[model samples]
Target: MKKWAILVAVMLLAINFSFSNGAGEAEAGGKEVVLVYDGDAFFSLISTSLAFHEGKVPMLLFKDDLAVQQKFIDDYGADGLIVVGRHVDAALPCREFLGDAVAVSLKIAEFFGKSSSVVVMPCSMDEYNLSLIATPIACYTDAPILLYDDNDDEIISAIDKLGAENVIGIGSVAIGNVHLKSEEEIYDYISDIRDVGYLAVTNPDDALKPEVTESQEMSFERHMKNIQITILSQKINLVGSDEATFSISVPDGISRIRAIVDVP
Candidate 1:
């Protein structure tokens, strides 16, 4: 009889373990992944929104009561929980991933099955205008926005481990070796830098990299050829467009090897 009791206890433990690991499949199957943030705080909301843009998940304002938070998660059928803010505690049945806005974004990106290319924005809400600028950029790039601080060693290491190819810095702040693509001077800089590329437009679109079309008026000349161009570094390929003209500027005795290229 004792042996049977022991066997039943073992089976129960196994079942609990299964539920813990597969909570999404067991309870929230076919539901959208959800992000839980401390809604009372504006900074938390905005920072968490960065991840939401990438995760494409609904946001659930976290309640102090664990039961209330659990119900909210159940109501939405959240496959995963990304808890934002340092103080917010999640006691959900599923896996509870915790981090500040920037750190959480890395987890959210993995949830969406995207490569970890992230946009670095200012950490404080005082730079709200800068954050506003970064939002569309993040959406277009399909990357999470990480708040920047010089001492953010953990965030820096996380980004490195992600094998991130393009780490874009928005606004005036410089994080790491990121070049400011928002300025006009980047055009000249592009030519000088070996692997640098430029994307210019009379009217910029919501796309991180805009599409280039052929321009019949602007034909490629012989001297204007073979200049290497790319979009977001290497994410997209570009070619010359008849709609766009490639003009080369070289000093005396220097050859104009290529005219210009358009991003495809």
Candidate 2:
């Protein structure tokens, strides 16, 4: 290849990389297999790698669109996409919250199938959504999901009475009071939860290294364990004993990302 031709190719490659990673003359890697979650599901969804503070709700909302989600599939050659949802309401437009979520789930199932994989975590309607309606909220939603309840005893008892096989618990419901402190403090919280025969699913705040309970180390004032966890019932038999495996999907190129969505 001519030197000039090679130079042109390099320049074009740089431009493409900039275009995909960011706007304004950024370049994207052609062979990098950059998975873009081009779906609306990620719009407001939060990740755990962020610093928590007041007014940081955007860090934890499920607002991605379809286009982005599909792109991720194409780019990664991903085998499966589990459409896990944060929080959903029971009553609402049949097509809006739970309705749309179910639709997304179906689309994923149909598109990926046994080949690649696409599925949604249909919402659950439990007490937390109800509590939000009774109190103040950052935003309004009709997604179907259960609430964390924030109390450890309530969650464990729920699993025991309801049977762990029938359901899985999410979020800091395991950490309890210690969550208000620092990441190191969270250990005691986790210990407390485990003692009760419950599990604590990891999120951005806890997943990220040096988990800072306060928003920032210096400004160590305002912080939030204020997020919620949502769940869906499995085909679990109420008579069987089982534990739900909890995990969060991190954005491409981001490590240790953790964040929870609306609870219950």
lDDT scores in order: 0.45, 0.24
Which tens-of-lDDT digit does each residue in 75-120 have in candidate 1?
A: 6545544444434444443444466555555554444444446666
TM-score of 2: 0.22
RMSD of 1: 21.8
TM-score of each: 0.44, 0.22
What is the Cα-based lDDT of residue 18 in candidate 2? 18
Off by over 4 Å in 1: 1-28, 39-55, 63-80, 86-92, 99-116, 176-264
What digit string (tens of lDDT, one per residue) describes model 2 on residues 1-264? 101000000000111111211123323232221111223332112111010111111111223544434453444432221223333221111111122433333332222212211111113332222221211111111111223423345433433332223232222333222122233332332333322322223233323434333321121232233333335743534442333334434447544433444332
Q: Cα lDDT for residue 252, model 2?
A: 77
In candidate 2 the C-alpha lDDT for residue 65 amounts to 40
| Residue-pair clashes, model 2 | 52
